[model samples]
Target chain A: MDAALTLLSFGPDGWGDDIATGVLVTVGLALATLPFGLVLGFFVALMKQSEEPSMRLAGNIYTTIFRGLPELLTLFLIFYGAQLGLQQITALFGEETTIEINAFAAGMVALGIMFSSYASEVFLAAFRVIPRGQYEGAYAVGLSHTRTMRLVILPQLIRVALPGLGNLWLILLKDTALVSVIGLSDILRQTGVAARVTKEPFLFFGLACLLYLVLAVLSSFVFSAIERWAAKSGGTR
Target chain B: MNAVAADLVERPPTPSRRWTGTRIAGTILVALWALAIAGLALYLVQSWNPELFDRYAGRYWSGLIVTLQLVFLSIILGAVLSIPIAWGRMTKRRIPSALAYAYVYFFRGTPLIAQTFLIYYGLGSFRPQLEAVGLWSFFRDAWNCALFAFTLNTAAYQAEILRGALESVGRGQWEGAASLGLSRLHTLRLIIVPQALIVALRPYGNEIILMIKGSAIVAIITVYDLMGETRRAYSRSFDFQTYLYAALIYLAIVETLRNVIEWIERRLTRHLKR
Candidate 1:
């Protein structure tokens, strides 16, 4: 029975294909959501820095609502609510079609939103850590605000932000499991389905943990390499 | 508008230059969000079928009670258990410290879902041996098994947080206490642990919020917590809106807990001048 659970056999027979598919999806979801999160986080961080009463207020509200809400709740809210809203919008066009949002997209949106809130704080903290002298030096060089940010602030921000970004990546990788609830065929979901079908919950779950352990270990190695590379670049450009 | 008021009271403005586009965008965004929230509230009120609520309210209530009980108990047990784990890590020993590190690394490395499954299902594999050892009775109940998993997992993370807090107490401070001829235990209990607790309090509060959310994962087991109940409702009714309702309940619980955490952090740290 244990030998039958090997990865290569057909579905409902061996977990090989399922485990492989789950890992790919998990990695895919994590990689896809990361950039979207960074972009959203950048805007939020900028908003957090806004001097205007309203801009700061909006930024604060965005972070507060998302941060206060559980990752699972946000996933459900956007998953169902977004679908319903899309359906309503289609109805206005007289199509009257029920459009379904894919579970992967919904999961990405939810994870992206959550990660953006946290990454914004990381960016904000990085922004604060930039030496005031650098900005003044950029000003002395007659660099415009945008150029100054790109040339001076960003390079330093990335350096200070590397450790945090690494931490965020690890977190996002783990959180990809939340997609299991939305019915995505990720590792956890695959394990769950296998558990239900095979009635061998222990085998599937044990395998799932081993799979995650592999991913976590593999990711730490990647992050450590990045950390070393970042350090070797001599602090800041 | 009211939400803005709530937000502002919690986070006072740090002085910065006001930008016009930022203001316009900010106000529009906030207004849009407020409108969306108000709309959701109205939809819930208008579309709420009292019969449906009455029918499922029992399960929801039962689930809610279970959820709270599970979270509260795991945290209490996790808190008590974490101290020794943390102490073992901090003490100048090789083997115990190594074991402590391994425990934290393994648990923290994996997802809580994996941890719970591994505990409940993985342990169930050794049912005969467990029974022989007289431990199967404790592990047989889904709730007990889930509680044990959560407790161990939380203790690992908490141990790290506590260890960091303890290490942050300056070397001089430890020496100062030692010079006063205080015993090692006295220095730790009276000086080191108290100060560390004060520092650990905020992070620990955050952990509590984390555990509240984490408790939802126990639903995968036969134990019916809030999320489990939500899943059951959705499966039965096939209405995704039931999930939204569940999410809102979760959001409210998290928001209220977050506010409490912030209030406590501020109250505790008030002595440190900003």
Candidate 2:
């Protein structure tokens, strides 16, 4: 027990700092992917709801392909495939530059794309729930399409979307761990390192689990609070 | 004219049909673009060394079989385990409910990869204790540990789904059963469970799809599942196509299951459609 504590300590002989850094990287990766995912998801949702059949088909295909593949495969594809594709493109430009993607960037893009596919479904469902009359109502009031979307549709879409998005955020948080496979020293990777170094796999892995649990519990509380707010506002509207 | 104006004022505007030459051209352009992308993908695949694929075909098949086995076994065991957890969650007893909640909370909140590592590595650290209990053999095997972790993790999700489905059953159903002098167990078995199963069908499908994708994580623990084989192939050949092939297989499995689930859902919910 004393040795375990010493190994986990922040002192010169310990791995506490490394583990903390890993936690930070995991959080950072999740945060960075969130907005990219939301924007792409919103775009896909619009395409899905578009009047044009071709646009709708494209959206459907995108979601189907992304949602059908495993997240690890997606990450591997982007990490390796993107680099090769980029290198080929550079060659076409007569440049000798080799474009390498770090695990962080690859993870963000892959996870963002994956998250967007699921998020699009959620957003599309939220958009569908609004009555057709809402659009007609906005046009009748002489609001332009952009203004109507910004002022009216966006607010309600978010309220309806809050629960699903909250769930996706949790899933995304957990998925950030997958980046460790590509050598991004995230919490899981750090735990593995610590475990191997100290020959105490149980201690480090258990610590990692406890840390993830804390993050999950804390984030869930925040989501519930936001959900309550959304519900309240939805009622008022 | 007055009558016509009043009619116009009362009626909703007709949805305008605005398909023009430009719209047709745009549609053609989109179709052509999609076709071009598909053709490029086909060309790339066709150009790859078929010999490599042929050589590794056996390995890939075995990996796929292992993946399917793991997913099926874990899902089945998880479903069985979830019933008790679901009951605990549904019951009025404080201790069981709290215990169930804690289990779900911890399992669901963390990454499956983390849980897999914990089971695969963490338990191995207790070899002496496990050996004394005659359980070292089980903990020492990567496959067993992977299966155990997956079963526990999926059980949490399945339990929540079951709890939700059970709660969604109307109280009237229970009252009606009681009025008929049916016992609680009989009511649950004959009426409530059947109804709940239908309600739970979609979520169950989602859980299975999720488990299928998540089963890939076991590869990290040195289990030669689909993803594991892909990694091995990639390292040997240094060809990125290995990952692509694996992705294709995964996509096929997910797509087929999705269609099957949708068909089942439609069949089961046929009564509500009318």
Candidate 3:
């Protein structure tokens, strides 16, 4: 136990800096993916909510493909496939450009796509809850359909959607570790490096788990607080 | 939250032939979606390599089997373990409940890869002690270690699902069953469980789908699951088709299971709808 303490102690002598950076990268990756994912999801939900059959079909197919495919596979595809596509595009310029795509960007894009697929479902449900009366009422008051959705419906839909989206955030936080496989120096990979160097896999991996647990616990507290506020706003049950 | 689930019962809205501006945007979106599909098709055709199918077909098949076996066994085993854990979580005993909560909290809070490495590489560091206890061989096998980690990880999730489902059952049913002179076991089996099963069905389906997707991680540790096989094939041929095919296979499995579960839910709840 004493030896464990010495090895893990903060400073250049230990792995404190590496692990700290890993935590930041993991959280950063998740945050970067959130708004873009949420917006994509909102559009997909709009597609589903639209009266056109083709639009609804488009939404259904998007969710089915992304949600069903493994997250790891999706990441691998984007990481490698994007590189290939980029290489081809550069070839058109008559110059050899070896582009090693950023692992962080690949992870963000892949996870954002997946997040959107799931978020669309939540958005669909939230959008569905707004009574048809609200739309008709808005139209009766001379509001355009676009303005009604933008100003009236979407605002109320957010409160109902908060809890579900919060759960997805937790899932996304845990999923950030998958980026490590593509050589992103995330928390898991940093701990893994520490384990290999010190021959203390148990110690470092245990620390990684504890770090993730703390993040998850903290997020849940924040989400529950938000949920309570949403409830007090009198939208969702 | 149930709000996250897609509503299968959503009625088709009444047809309106009005060419609203929103409808034009919808049409444009659908056209763009079709164009994307066409681009993907073009890419697939352009990248076609029939040689990959001839060489790694068997390896891919075997890897898929391993993935199926691992998830199937872990889910079944996890379900068994969950019964006691869920009961513990729901029980009046403070110690057992707290212990159960801690177990679930730890597993749910941490990433699966972290848990997997802890069991695989972490336990490897304890070989001498494991050998002393005669469990070294089991821990040494990557398949066994993956199974153990997955079982434990999934047990926590399954337990939470069970506890939530059971708790969602109304208190009036239990009192009514006791008044009917039914034993505690009978009340659960006859009066409460069937009702809870319906509520649990979708989440249970979600868990199974998640496990199927997550089982891909065991591949990174060299257990040669589908994702592992894809990695190997990709390394050998430097082709993206390998991962694409594996993705298709997984998508097929998830979609089939989803439809199956939805069908079962409908069939089981046919009596309750009226």
Q: What share of the true interface contacts does each candidate keep?
A: 0.58, 0.71, 0.80
Question: Which clashing pairs does model 2 show?
Answer: none
- Cα lDDT of model 1 by residue, B219-256, tens digit: 77878988889878877876666776877777788788
Better of 1 and 2 by DockQ: 2
Report the Cα lDDT for residue A110, model 1. 95
What is each model's TM-score for chain A? 0.93, 0.95, 0.96
- Candidate 1 at B237: error in angstroms? 4.6
- Residue A179, model 2: lDDT of 96
Compose the digit string of candidate 2's lDDT tens values, residues A149-197: 9988998999989899999999999999999999999999998999998
TM-score of predicted structure 1: 0.89
**Complex DockQ per candidate:** 0.53, 0.60, 0.71
lDDT (Cα, tens digit) per residue for candidate 1, span A56-75: 77888888878877677678
| C-alpha lDDT values of all predictions | 0.85, 0.91, 0.91
Alpha-carbon runs more than 4 Å astray in model 1: A1-14, A195-199, A234-237, B1-19, B236-241
B1-274: candidate 2 lDDT, tens digit per residue: 9988887786677989688654575477578768956875885678689788798889999999999999999999999999999988888999999999899988999999999999999997888889999999988889999999999999999999999999999999999999999999999999999999999999999999999999998888999999999999999998877887898899999999999999999998999896
lDDT of 3 at B26: 68
**Would candidate 2 be rated incorrect, acceptable, medium or high by CAPRI criteria?**
medium
In model 2, which runs have C-alpha deviations exceeding 4 angstroms? A94-99, A232-237, B1-40
